[model samples]
Target: MTTKKILIVDDEAAIVAVLEELLTEEGYTIIKAYNGLEAISIFNKKQHIDLMIVDYCMPHLNGRRVIETMRQNPRYSTTPVIVITGSEKQFSNFPEDSTYQFLIEKPFNLERITETVHKLLG
Candidate 1:
């Protein structure tokens, strides 16, 4: 099977590193971004991304904005996205019609994430 590429966006370097390791071990290609702006840049440069795991709060552009920007391009309109947030209040601010396929709270279980990834990319 072909390798799936997943873009992981978070302001925390540790979160990105851990996710990178975990997902890489699952055999998916990972693209890392520390902040929203860099994520956007990477999104533009990469031809195709199978899925996204984004932090709800970030610098430059929030996860919502980043997802919005991505959805603007028809190619990514239906791409599976998983939003992770430490603050429940941040999630409350998001509209009901969120584009993301899943919402995972911070300090998430690695196995849960891996399962979600497999389900989404299956």
Candidate 2:
């Protein structure tokens, strides 16, 4: 099987670093972006991104906007996305029909995150 490419987006450097380390050990290629605009730019440049792990709050544009923009691209319309937010209530802001595959609250369990990734990508 081809290695899955996952984009890890978050304003917090620590979160990005930890996620990179974890997912890399799991054998997935990772692309990192510090904020939502950078995330969108990276998303445009990369092809076949198997998944995305995005923080809800971000600079330039929020995660919701980033995901909404990505959903416009037919190639990523159904791509699996994991939105990590500090508050579960933030999820309500997304449209009812949005395609975010998973919502992981802050202080998430690493094991659960890994399981979700495998379930979505597999």
Candidate 3:
């Protein structure tokens, strides 16, 4: 199978490290960003990205805002995104055209995320 590139955006270094290692082992290229600014910078440079896993609560910009900004660009408008949140609040009001618009609560499982990536990319 062709390799997929996944962007993991989170403020915490631990979360980014864990996801980078996990996705790398799954044979996917990982691009990591600590904040929304960094994420946008990478997105601007990289022309193609298969999927994005973003954390809800971040320092610079929240996951929701990041996703919203991403969708504004036609290039990434259809990109699949998985929002990770530790809060009990629900996420709604996102684009419906997306194929993989999912919200995975924090303390997420590796297997679950891997399955999600496979389903979205496949």
Expressed as tens digits, the lDDT of each residue in 18-112 for candidate 1 is 99999999999998889889978876875689999999888788888889888888878888999998877445656235688899888999999
lDDT of 2 by residue, 95-115 (tens): 333568888889989999999
Q: Candidate 3 on 1-118: residue-level lDDT in tens?
A: 7688899999989999999998899899998889988888877785588899988788878777788778878889889898877865544643232433787888999899889888
- Model 1 stretches with alpha carbons more than 4 Å out: 89-92
Clashing pairs in 3: none
Cα lDDT over the full model 3: 0.83
TM values, all candidates: 0.92, 0.91, 0.88
In angstroms, give how far residue 39 of model 3 lies from its true place: 0.8
The candidate with the higher lDDT, 1 or 3, is 1
lDDT of each: 0.88, 0.86, 0.83
Model 1 residue 69 distance off true place after TM-score fit, in angstroms: 0.4
C-alpha lDDT of residue 70 in model 1 = 86
The residue pairs in collision within model 1 are none
Window of ten residues with lowest summed lDDT in model 3: 91-100
Write down the TM-score for model 2. Answer: 0.91
Root-mean-square deviation per candidate: 1.6, 1.7, 2.5
Clashes of each: 0, 0, 0
Q: List residue ranges in candidate 2 displaced over 4 A.
A: 90-92, 95-97
